[model samples]
Target chain A: MYVAVKGGEKAIDNAHKYLAEERRGATDVAELSLSQISEQLSHAVSRVMAEGSLYDKDLAALAIKQARGDLIEAIFLIRAYRTTLPRFGYSAPLDTSEMDLDRRISATFKDLPGGQVLGPTFDYTHRLLDFALAAEGLEPQKAEAAEAPLDEEVPRVLELLNAEGLIEQSAPADYDDTAPVGDLTREPLEFPADRDLRLQNLARGDEGFILALGYSTQRGYARNHAFVGEVRLGDVTVEVIPEELGFAIEIGDITITECETVNQFQGSKTAPAQFTRGYGLAFGHSERKVISMALVDRALRCHELGEDQVAPVQDDEFVLSHSDNIQATGFVEHIKLPHYVDFQSELELVRRLRRNAEDNIREAAE
Target chain B: MALDSSPGDPSRKNWMGILARASETDLENFWQLHGQEEDYDFLRRPEIGLVMVQGRAGGTGGRFNLGEMTVTRCSVRLSDGTVGHAYIAGRNQRHAELAAAFDALLQNPERQEEIEDTVITPLQKRHQQGRDDRSKKAAATKVDFYTMVRGED
Candidate 1:
């Protein structure tokens, strides 16, 4: 191997070829298909969509395959692709109330109006891995359908608390026309973002960062008891109401997992104690991410609700500002960029200082 | 009215005529922007600024210098009880007002709809227009021209 190299472009191409061969494995075996990844490795696809901030399963699966199963790399691929796509018009927010019932459940009340539809969840399955799956001999079994029809809206569990005046009053819904906070992608994120924008950032934030922040809450960095008020996973139609159309046209259906957490909070002496809310919603069926998001959300509500701010996790501004994986990782990794100019300045200063010290030593010896 | 993503203020109306008829969407979408977050409450309460600067000193212990910057900050208690703090790098009254108004609107249950329609949309429009203009200007300056003489070979 030569100590000096000049064929950077050629080296890069060769390295890429080697990587591709390694990723594809043996020529004797058939290459993996995108469909297989989407079906069998759905969780990776979901994570990519959640972090990459895109909702297409096929694209996510392709990214995963192309990235050699690196979810973060897959997310980077989707994000890069998303940046190049031309922006059409904005679609109106999806109406969850009109969302076709898929999987709806309320932990507050076991048998609510919308009967708990387990949907496709790993909750009931034993932790033990099935050895038959390794041999590809097992067939998935479908569960029997329950007789009861689930309701359209499983009336939010918080409503029950609101009736008794036990929980925080629902913030008035009169602000529908408010412009959404500017995207951090277009511009940098300024501090003190509102709860809505902050939540959006957290939803699209890196999984590991949010997971760590959420873990801090459990470790008593901020103690807000979080109860999974609702965790629903299913498809929701994306509708765009074109000016000429005069009505919403269904773009497509996207699978989403929404988790809303009800947190226990003690109010100031002037006000009665109530359960505050921390909501988490993410694209695709990502219950783990959703649950993690909800916990972090609750922890961030300390200052807003007049609760004593005792933990780092309780700082809304800090958590929301720092939890973004893209920004955090980008800033952290950007140190690899050319810093030779600054390093050169330091190097000159060091040589001068060392020479001065050596001169002082020589003078003392004389 | 200005679009949500545009730069400069329509209310200030300083350069409104030049931007009014622009395709607001195109203007807003064309450029990259960076946002800075400042701790307004911390700055205003104590009336002091602590600016941190780090540099390598003699390739030994890293050196840190605390320089004072003229920082202006404000806090707004929105009608809905949400308080927003905005601190800018310099003493710009307009930036403070804009930040405060945005803060108020973000939390106002009553005026949110009106504020979005009247304020945010127009600002965004202006911002976008400026971005598009700059990008086009940059594109125009980009030259990738080369030539070779046929007889020389």
Candidate 2:
């Protein structure tokens, strides 16, 4: 009888060697630079940074190159690295009011304080693909802007709703004073999660997973009519106030896409009639992700706003608990690991069933 | 609660906490049986169970256990004046302790660095030593059987 093979170490070592060789294909050619990846494959970099939960452009670019441009692998690398980094201190919650926005647009109002400046968007671009870029060694020319900068702070759309008392006031008193928000990474997701936990899930949740969950709401599952109250793409300041310093220090700026959704909600006996909120904020320019997140967030608020828990997709506990792609991926991939013992038991049961059937057939014949 | 107590007290204050722990021991036992304690701990708390789940070299099934394991876990202090926990796989006690220390660190925000250096590093080294001990025992058990074959017509 052929016994089980036992050269796994050698096989794994050889596989690594082969992988290294494949990763560095065409050894004569110069390897792609991190700066090139960051600049050229910016969208991929953004996605990696967003999902990886690390905002460093250079490191993300390096991850992309190291993972052979596999965005998910790049994200995995970033996450692994992120887990290792020592938690020195946490910066206080960002004040978006002081954000120096590079690009800000409000879909709710046409003429806001900050007039809409269409900054580097593909909304008006022609459908035809540009073939001229394929030609080698062509130096790109910078396009000149025709319009002057509309330097005005766009009033928050939510603020407008609040002014009319149309939206529920998100007062600080609503949150628990003693028990603050806990990091989702540190703790296992529990059922009947609060808004903070749900938001945390949306923030770190896989784009595709959030997108699909968000889509379910629009397909009449949650029946939440979501309007993009505001979608602001800008550079938000990250302030670090050291214990020794005792004052807020401007560490750096990070690109963020913040989307706030307004959904219709009727006042029940216990709650007042108001517009519920679904907020989405992601690292880098992930508009689709942010918008989708907002929708999902609003749908999840059905129970909190004293509305009927009408849909499976709207259940805060279910959605928040099962939203993590990392957990899902790990469990799914673990199935590839050893299961022979389980398989053996299954095989024995099947054999016994077959023998019993054969005996019945023989008895009938006799 | 006395720091320098009589040996016979058994520490009821600490004992109640242990009792509380034993009450919820079913989950821990369930994990000990089916779940890879180290892997689960690693995800939850990196500092405690930093020992890697070294897969078997080769076997009938994919990545058999081969009755060998190394694990790291951490006991932590919760913010609510309660002790916390995390257990992980692997020899990185620093990983476990950092996770544990981080749990403690998150609660107080005062003694982050002290815990990092004092608790995390030593635990990591101990975890590695445990792995080394297991490997050494396995190595000592190694034996080879040989036979001289006689010429047969």
Candidate 3:
């Protein structure tokens, strides 16, 4: 039970003032601008956006600034701000196949349609610290441009396997857009959650948490022999068919990272052995997060695929309930918020019980 | 609000995509130069809202809610009664208003060619240039694997 204790109004106000001053840091240093955070610390902003479940880069950057670089705090701020805004509608499910490809690669196949394009990535970079970045006014070398541009559309690697029926199809044969999809934001997540709900949960799940869960699976805790089928990063146009407009109009584009994992699935008596699929998608270039999401996604699909649910990751309720960091942080951190009354009640009970026990022992002796 | 009688016009979709994706600064400059004198009334005032973004299960399967993105939408009716609607990403009120105003203006047959030339064309060029620059750089990074012949072979 929570009790509202009054008083300390002046102290609370002064504490906030001190916090503001502290947030400014040393006066000699130039202030960090929102643009700088949005541009330079973009990966941080992306994580906040992905976890916060909001897409406004500027607002995410501002939240990061307000939270003093505490990403979870920034995500909390974003989530809070999101609740206040009115919802317009839902966008058409993004067609990632038509995405303006920046980075596309496949681990399962060396050569595939729309040959591997390595866009801007740190995969090949040595992890040594570049002190040159610390000093300002350093002009970075420009990247070389190819004589000819890449193809407009690149086929997904999974599509190649789908052609030969070697891998299970990702979409249903009778997929319909009009069919209502489960939205956890609008409704509470119920048990026996479908793949849609699971994906949504993992999409916004805490990166580190999801990464750990995915890594555990790799260490033989429900290992599916996962192969990185494809990882693509680029901008995809978002379209919403406004009621008034009666036709779809592009709202804008958002950069996202998508991962598709091909897992080994031994066929049953009635079915033929074919590779299965796991999917992960998140806002911005969240490579690690998406990859983790894909692995967890596949693990949660054990029941559907007729596999034994022997691991924690295979349990949908456990993964989905604890995936959201905002929810997790609130329950964990609420203990710090004035639990004095509750503690006092417990203290009194303990003292009374101890006294009664001592008195009973003395009476017996007498 | 009256619906667009001919919603199947592909050009309208293309131009709207371009306008929605155009940078805020560029849109503002274009509006100031070509559309400052345009008269329109707000059917729906510029309001910030959320649009739930959905994604496919396996990039080709059933749909699922990914997350909500910030979108500002507005509706405007021109003096000549042509209605324009804008649903752009992000929370810029002025950007929505300007895009709606242009949409209404672009719908006018008399002014269509002129506005398309003066405003939309330049914006499209700038947008194309930015896309090409990034695509080219990415193209440069495409790996070309080569196999070396061993002396034993």
Candidate 4:
């Protein structure tokens, strides 16, 4: 039993107008500019880009402004805008090795190549809030330049382990460049997904959800003795081979955070004992997200790695289905939208049952 | 546009990259000064689109879709039948058109040297300077470790 009731058009329009007024806040105060949001609230923009699966910082900032700083709402706006654009083609896979190093660190090694450059990090700072920031017009401090430049070639730490056959190779033995990768946007996700599909889903997954899952692993829920092999944040140039042009051309560069985790894996009957690997890469300086993504990535490999899948994080269907905040929010919020007919039927059934019970009690008493 | 299938010419590729990565304002200024006089027609109008960015599994593995990025592309043909194409990041149609126009002019052997001297060289220097400044700042943050000597050893 379904019915349509259309009304409140004027009320809806008024509500929207009120919302705009509320969003603007005080008239005396200056409105926040898009550049300010993009530069100052960059982490928020970065998160929106990662989850929204779009990499335009200006648009993300604009969405932030339009959504009144509700990041998920901003992400929704970006996703909607992104769906309308025509796709040119796929770009060549990004090479992290050539990233213009910003912040590169390795917890596993005390001293490695590149020597752990801590470029613009909050890691060493005190957690206490600085009252000085409240007072505007403070002069910005410039960092000192080094006498000598960093090495041209900073090698990856895992390559050292791979050289001695001490770690599992990240790529397949028979990797092909021409083979097609799985695309979730084009097709619905199926069970028993490959690493490629899983990575794609996790890359655009909700930060909070992924963080909780990663934290679960740390609390001994399908733990894999994880070690932070290396975490690098920097800019990498994006190149695409256009159909008109026969060769690749650089479009632009984007900042990304990459994490590679080495996990202890007791070799199975068919495999040799060696260190296994989990990887995470996301747009912008998302250290926590990438680190968490790596942890969950390793956990999801339980079946393939010959480990027991005993936790919710290890369940692919549960994790993948609930990871997307946009999908989760839409379904949860839809309950507020019109369930009147459904509830009315249940109400009538319950009342009828209660009446019958009361009549039966009276008859028994008589 | 005539297709030059001669492989291993790195100069054309380098210039194209420089033009793509250069700021729109800078490109516009340079175009107004030097490229405004060139007669050209649009082969394909500047169109904004998305390009799906891919990433390696472990930074060195098989490819996976990371996400899509906005790109604007255009193709133009010069009066002399030399064709130029541009694929730059972000949704700026004017920037793409200007880049395409410059690309077409650069393909002409007669105008190649002068354009390279005025437009390409200056843009390259500015880009390099920015990169150098960033690299130097990062270098300053590089950790320097020192070990204390113990008499017991």
Instruction: Please write out the lDDT profile of model 4 over residues A149-175, one tens digit for every residue.
Output: 677888888887888888999887888
DockQ (model 4, Cα):
0.77
Best-fitting candidate, scored by DockQ: 3
Model 1 per-residue lDDT at A72: 76
Task: Report chain A TM-scores, every model.
Answer: 0.87, 0.90, 0.97, 0.96
Error of 4 at A117 (Å): 1.1
Instruction: Put down candidate 3 lDDT per residue, A1-366, tens digits, no spaces.
Output: 668889999999999999989999999999999999999898999999999999999999999999999999999999999999999999999999988888999999987778888988899899999999899898977999987777886898998999999999887667676889999998999998999999999999999999999998999999998999999999999999988778888988999999999997678899898999999999998999999999999999999888999889999999999999999999999888898899999999999999999999999999
Weakest 10 consecutive residues, lDDT, candidate 2 chain A? A143-152
Q: How close to the true structure is residue B99 of candidate 1, measured as C-alpha lDDT?
A: 54
Which candidate would rank higher by lDDT, 1 or 2?
2
Model 4 TM:
0.96
Q: Model 3: runs farther than 4 Å from truth?
A: A173-176, B1-5
Please report, in order, the local distance difference test score of every candidate based on alpha carbons: 0.57, 0.57, 0.91, 0.89
Put down candidate 2 lDDT per residue, B1-153, tens digits, no spaces. 112122223222222122122212333342244322222122234331111111110000011110111233455444344333333322444544444434333233354345334543444455445434433332332222356788995
Per-candidate DockQ values are: 0.01, 0.01, 0.82, 0.77
Best by lDDT: 3
